[model samples]
Target: MMACIQFLLLFCSFMYIFNVNPSCAQIPNSPIRSLVLPVTKDPATFQFLTTIYHGTSREPIRVVLDLGCPSLWLDCSSGRLSSSRRLIPSCSIQCAAAKPNNMSCAFSAAMPTRKRTACGLSTENSIARSATRGELVEDILTVESVDGSKAGPVTTVDHFLFSCAPRFLLNRLARGAQGMLGLGKSRIALPSQLASKFGLQRKFATCLSSSDGLILFGHEPGYDSIFGTEISRSLMYTPLVTSPDGSGSSQDYSINVKSIKINGKRLSLRQKGIGGGTKISTTVPYTTLESSIYSTFIKAYKESATNNYFLNMTVVAPVAPFGLCFSSKEVPSSMLLGPMVPVIDLVLQSEMVKWRVHGRNAMVPVLDEVMCLGFLDGGSKSKTSSSIVIGGFQLEDNLLEFNLGTSMLGFSSSLLTRHTSCSDYHTRMMQSTLKDS
Candidate 1:
């Protein structure tokens, strides 16, 4: 009896320590929901989650495996994201079919070297030399099977190209989405090993929405699942959140409005929009959305866009935008809907100074200041130089809100002052006049 009691007690202790609270313990380690990250110039690397889909059946059987680090390379011919790209036929080799050096030889030849230049940007660097009139390059995922011992040769068709890029630049500058996956039947792209090893057979699906339209991923049914690290975690990636189930539901995320102080007066920022939500979008054109408000405020202050004046102050939280995942679309809807992932409202940790303008008099003070930060685009051949690109500044909401023509200047809240009054100028101009008198 004594021995039995000791054993029972030990077992109970073990269970308690593990918190074998079946309900919470049952939750899979993988995030049920897939987060949409903001478009990044570099790449994301990590040991995240993976879901496998079979081409013929179009189903998701499992999603829990380790995808080693993957690289998302830019398609030089067209400035867009790409996983394992096609080899230029010219790069083909004469290796006998028996030896099968096709994949190796082809990849070596087509991979952009520091020597190639396309569209004014070096194919080697992949960064746009001058902003072009084409599609915005977005996410580039490279997937490989972790279970290499069991699989045969991986096929080229096994790769995928998801269409997700900025729409405005699509026709003007973006490369035509080269052989993008059609959401048609029986087409497959996810690396085969993920299916065989992880038991992930269902084709996971999601829509990257934007002002443009909904973008389907996993290609209707067949799609490529690049195995490896995401580009953002590896480079300069902004943060973002995902729905709990990876369902892409808007309700799953958070958005916060910290404080709204107008002209040194505090106002409870609790106004709701049409849907009883915090944010509302007007059909107004981008240029006009804030133009009229800005104009009215500046004109009243007798200033120009160059002049710093009136502002609407708002504090924001930080969340990663999702649009960064797809770069192959002629006009990826992600550009419209994915980039703004209410990080501010969702996290509610940090505060951002919003430069808002209401009707007339400079309600908010103008903080004239400049700052310099660092930018890192790791893909550049020169890693050191690529790490410090001299970015911009940032502003806070103490007494003023900072802004430029329409750019995110930076995060510095330092202010600049002007001595426009003749009296103020004369004080500096004629210090001797006052002393002599």
Candidate 2:
């Protein structure tokens, strides 16, 4: 009886222990809802780069943030391949997810002579305007998890699929950047994969600046404490539209712009210019508008600056990229929005929804004495599909939330108006995390 009792006691103890603290394999990982990537702008290239830890070694890999890219791709030759990496076979389900029409696998000329049944993915260098074939491979990826208020412990995603491109494809990318981190709406895009893994809402936010910035994957928490005002509350959203002609990737995000206004005065623009749609690009340094739209905008802006804000401002010689230049001595500065100039408003779906562009975003300083209009004349409508390509300069210091679930883009015009910059918020977040750690 004593032996049986002892056995029963042992069984009971085991059951209690199991219930209290399960084995490592049996314990399911807690879902990490949010992840953050530290973004930094490349001074020479004017491109934004974000860091992600990859492979067994957890090596930090910096990659360009491309909103239109279909998937994350890297120049495999640049970094040591992790032993845990797995090559995806051609015509496999994973390959189909990445490239729907991909049938036969053809190895790149730069690939090794050894024959392997690996999936071939097409990778592009948007800046260099080059395309090359890359092998699809999977490895572990790690990123810092956050809870809106503070940064948490590091979380990882095993078996993260990415392309292995040739070393030559790395040309024209930001210095030290190994590849591109695609945030497009494709199945294999970084944001989509992260959302799927964490069971998070299909949304992400980007706060871009000249220095360090932040990119949050998944639903963001309240920003009231950080920015003085709640970013979610102040965000103005507009429907994300796809181009009719579909010249670029179907996953590319675009918005419908109804009209443009300078200092509350509507600019006379052709309906065709407005109908072409406006696409967001991180690669483009400055905002580019169609020739007709540019002409109308420049004329109206010049008139506004001369008559309203800077009556004594002298028109200096036109800068290389910018057609309009003004003497900085005559241009007044503001505490809230850098230069005291006319506000440029982009009217969206309705008259009520407008993206107000402050002076800081409208003007760029080329020299100590000269400040020029930052906008570029993007040839004709035939040359480019997008009527207006909103570039990185205009997007800097802006808090933009791209919600893939609702197909809506929520934007906080400029963080400067809120008396906070992306760099400031990022620095604080990092410092807070360090202090807590």
Candidate 3:
């Protein structure tokens, strides 16, 4: 009995081990102060979202951390959630009916893009619209976080407002995230609501890599605490600007980029005479390059490679929607020989920041050898006045922080030296330690 007790004590010690993988670059001096889990990258779809546990029963629901969206939603039609209501249209008599007790009521969600047209008249004296059906529920939602008291603690939000989507045209990509957790500037969004409810600051950070990273809360215990003092001071920061058109769509993390360079050759994309027109953008799910900018970028890329290769080895005329296509066998492992792609630098006037999107993030791997540019074309002129929309692919290893308190968008190089995550390393140690004991 004494031996067994000793074994139990030894096993508990192993469970707390972290970053056991020596290959990891920089281990956080302390445990990370965030709720983090490995993301689900649908290899077939290139979706970098994760499913989370929510509701009273803690049912699993896949959600996207979308800054572009303004609310949290779940798919009830999937049959995963048991308590959900389908709302009736205002034009119908059921709309004036009394609220149901104990049961949550579903309603037509206001899709900003579609206002008045966002509803439907039910046939049984009511009609539910196509993409706007959902519910407003008050329940306890749980989130796992590091409380400084222990390694992991449950964050419960009582009477939280979220949606239940009964009908939202979910395709291969949209279906990847059954619900969307809005990180936008809107107060109704999850982050803002989470902060206001808990009296915590509205600052959050995400170190999202392909493997494992964390979504941290409360600025006090985040990067500043996790990173050593010297390392924290060296981080780069820029103002989180609003939409160029002053549309007040606070979702975009905008910055003024001066020019783009390849091998130090400024791509002649600078502002010409009196007025300038260069905007590089990165938004959630995509990083977009202006039409002319992308064309010039591709041309320069082709000239830089040996044998004047654009997307080398791969052949086939450029297809619709995509201009540059490459054969699977022909592409190099990285255009970036080091921290940057061979010699590409995106020069920004904000703080004279020269950000480099590593080759791994710049060129997305579609399949075996098939690769495509990670950026999309938002036409020569975007209706929103944004020339470029910075997307997810370009943010691979970087840790991005959107701090409302400081009104700054800060970023730093990958905390992990290599690709392996701390969580994976910890799990492996637990498994091995148990076996040896």
Winning candidate number (TM-score) = 2
Ten-residue stretch with the least lDDT total in model 3 = 121-130
Query: Candidate 1 residues 103-216, lDDT tens each?
Result: 332335544551132112111111122222222122223222211111111221132322222333222112232112211111112222122222233223221111111111
**Superior candidate under lDDT, 1 versus 3:** 3
lDDT of 2 by residue, 1-437 (tens): 65564444444433332222333112226657577888899999999998888888998888999998888999877777687888987644566567644423232353244234788888888888899999988888888887556677888777687898998988899889999998998767898777766666778888999899988886545344444456657799999988777655676778998899998999888654576579888889999998888888888888888776335567889989899999888677987698887889989999999888998998898999889999999878763378898999999999888999999999889889878889987898889998887
Q: What order do you get sorting by lDDT, best first?
A: 2, 3, 1
What global local distance difference test value does model 3 have? 0.50
User: TM-scores across all candidates?
Assistant: 0.20, 0.88, 0.67
CA deviation > 4 Å runs, candidate 3: 1-38, 80-135, 147-151, 172-176, 224-233, 271-286, 306-322, 325-341, 366-372, 413-437
Model 3, 20-86: lDDT tens digits are 2344323234433454333544444444566666666777777655554545666556645545233
Q: After superposition, how far is residue 274 of candidate 2 from its true place, in Å?
A: 1.7
Evaluate residue 423 in candidate 3 and report its C-alpha lDDT on the 0 to 100 scale. Answer: 39
Off by over 4 Å in 2: 1-28, 101-116, 220-229, 309-312
How well does candidate 1 match the true structure, expressed as C-alpha RMSD?
A: 24.5
* TM-score-better candidate, 1 vs 3: 3
lDDT of 2: 0.80
